[model samples]
Target: MLRNSPLHPLARFLLNIISPLEGNTLSAVKNTQHFVRIIKEQHVTQQDLLVSFDVTSLFTNVPTNKALDVVKKKLSEDESLEHRTSLSLNAIMEMLNMCINTTYFQLDDEFYQQEFGVAMGPITSTQRYIHGRL
Candidate 1:
């Protein structure tokens, strides 16, 4: 079904324009110094605990529809910030569907479509932007 969809390219294009890298709000640690400074500022104590989250293959785990719903809510709330972005929430959501819903993979020479789950890679930050708010 998705393989024949004509809007797919348009969707991807819109997604590219609205890509999250353009507005990275994260103060991503660039080096050991930044990591050390953050850790030092935390003032770790003997009673305090350290934690690490494992999101390996996390993209395949997210339910596409539910995540999309969350993205919709986020978009609605952030509508006031629309001046920063040209695409409407509807356009972004539509592109998101076309981007993630049509994922196809090969197995022993056969191709199968992924009906659910968000695709990984460039879409990762978008996923974080939507989910991190919750």
Candidate 2:
């Protein structure tokens, strides 16, 4: 169904423009510099003891299903659809459908499949923007 959709390219273009602003390479460099500065200022030594923790599947825990449900409910409740012309409503519906269908899969057979729908309304992209696979 998605492959037959004509609006997919437009949806992808809009997503590229609206994805989250975090995780930029420049931001990562800046963050590293700031961290080093803080360490130097605090005189934290390796012998002072360091504790590190790692999280697995951090973004996967964001409740994408819940987010998708909320978006669908809000769209259904909007009274604007009643006043808008049929053409306008159709355009909005197309975008919503595209948003709902957007997803990516992992290549490894052992990895869990990753799927995401609308996590933020039209202005924001899904949470797994920088996934290594897709």
Candidate 3:
């Protein structure tokens, strides 16, 4: 799938490394949810804000290479391996890749005329819900 596709190469590499990490994905999702909730609560209570500005094209503004690099470094960190963080990393990476592919194809990008690769991580359904927009 990586050999002939428009998806970023770094995304593919991360997917390869994360394929073996088993449990990290769910934890990552939960962590993100927790983080978001905390932020929302803080905004509501501390800032007295009921509305938050969500900027679209947020991910598009993130350089794909940089995002993949951060993921790769985190996945390969000694602390992560020692604590078995790869599992969640793998699951999240796979989920993100699926989301990106789906979004890309939905945009009718001519370069994205291919099927998504295998799903190797856990929390498959939840991941889809969390990152379906990529």
Give each model a TM-score.
Answer: 0.56, 0.30, 0.31
In order, candidate lDDTs are 0.60, 0.46, 0.47
The residue pairs that clash in candidate 2, if any, are none
Candidate 3 regions with alpha-carbon error over 4 angstroms? 1-51, 78-134
Q: Which ten residues in a row have the lowest lDDT in candidate 3?
A: 106-115
Q: How badly does each model clash, as a count of residue pairs?
A: 0, 0, 5
Using lDDT as the measure, the top candidate is 1
Q: Sorted by lDDT, highest first, which candidate order results?
A: 1, 3, 2
Considering every candidate listed, which one attains the maximal TM-score? 1
Q: Candidate 1 regions off by >4 Å?
A: 1-12, 21-35, 79-81, 84-86, 121-134
Which lDDT tens digits does candidate 1 get at residues 1-134?
23345555676565554544333345567667977887887777799999866657676678889977866775666634466567777877887776767665444465545544665543343443333211
What residue pairs are clashing in model 1? none
Q: Write the per-residue lDDT of candidate 3 for residues 1-134, one digit (tens) a residue.
A: 33434445655655555555534554353456776875665534575646646564343345554655666665666354534344665665565655444432323232222223332223233234334432
For residues 28-116, could you state the per-residue lDDT of candidate 2 as single tens digits? 53556786775676667678986657755444455665744544454465555444334443455456555555543333343222354
- Could you tell me how far off, in angstroms, the CA of residue 78 lies in candidate 3 after the best superposition? 5.1
RMSD of each: 8.5, 11.3, 10.9
Error of 3 at 30 (Å): 5.7
- In model 2, the Cα lDDT at residue 42 comes to 69
Write down the TM-score for model 2.
0.30
Cα-lDDT of candidate 2: 0.46
